[model samples]
Target: MILIGQYDSPFVRRVAIALRLYGFNFQHRPWSTFGDAELIAAYNPLRRVPTLVLDNGETLIESAMILDYLDELAGPEKALIAARGPQRRQCLKSCALATGLADKAVSLLYERVLRKDHPSQIWVERCEAQIGAVLDALEKERAAIASPFWFGTRIGHADVAVACALRFTGEAHAGVFDDVRHPALADHASRCEAMQVFREFVQPLIPPKG
Candidate 1:
């Protein structure tokens, strides 16, 4: 298996971290969508990161689809998400919120950094509000949980997604997301980052040049 994309992206980072947790041995391409657009497009027409090349020469695009495939490969007992029922719904909700937060952060970042000549203040403001709302909701949900992870004692997809999103949000929009206001989320991110899997796959964000 080959994992293509830089870890700076929350989407890619989550997939990489999951591969590590699942004990999957694969190659890391660390390709940038900006510099390696053509190469990535060959595998993913959308030209997106977190593209996974399976051992059988099949390519998987999108973080969610890649994760679902991986979960199946790992089998039901070892899957990161619950097989079914209320737990599955809750887990998916948390992951959705985190991924949505990451999407807004990336959008906000592009609006500010990529659109230097004609940046839209309105779009930036909307993205900021969405990011804030996701953070507030996630923080409250995390605070109510007594377990170390989003789902009981074991680490799951939601935990990885939230941690990756938080890290990317902080890196892309420094000083915007206040750690003081989200103590639970702050602490949760710290714990996840401390894990060996996360530490090993970590990469710093590299904003586009102006």
Candidate 2:
């Protein structure tokens, strides 16, 4: 398998981390959507990161779809998410919240950096509010979990998603995220970053300068 896109993106980073946890070997392209738009468009018409090129010449776009395929490949017991029941719903909900936070962070960053001349304060404020709301909800959920991982003792999709999103949020927005407000989430991100897989597959966030 070939994984395209830089790890600076939370979406790409989460997929790369999951591949390592699932013991799947793949080549990393580390392409930038800004610089490698044409190259990425060949594999993904939408020109998005986290495009997974399968061994048999099939391509998968979007992190969630790639993750779903990988979960199936890893089998039910070893999958990063619960295969069924309430646990699955909980994991999915957590992932949705984390991803939504990441989406807002990306939007906010673009609004500030890319739209220098006409950046909308309203859009920035809206995105900031959404990011804060998601973080508050996730912090409460993670705080209530007494176990090491979000779902339980074992690491799951929710744990990875939240950690990746938190890292990106801090990197992209600088002082926007308050650690005191989300201590559990801060700790969770730190623990995940300490892992060898995360260390190996990660990239420093490089926000565009004004």
Cα lDDT, all candidates = 0.94, 0.92
Error of 2 at 16 (Å): 0.4
Tell me how candidate 2 scores on lDDT: 0.92
lDDT of 2 by residue, 117-170 (tens): 999999989999999999999989989988889877888899999999999999
Candidate 1 residue-wise lDDT, 79-149, digit = tens? 99999999999999999999999999999888888898899989988999999999999999999999999
Each prediction's RMSD to truth = 0.8, 1.0
Best by lDDT: 1
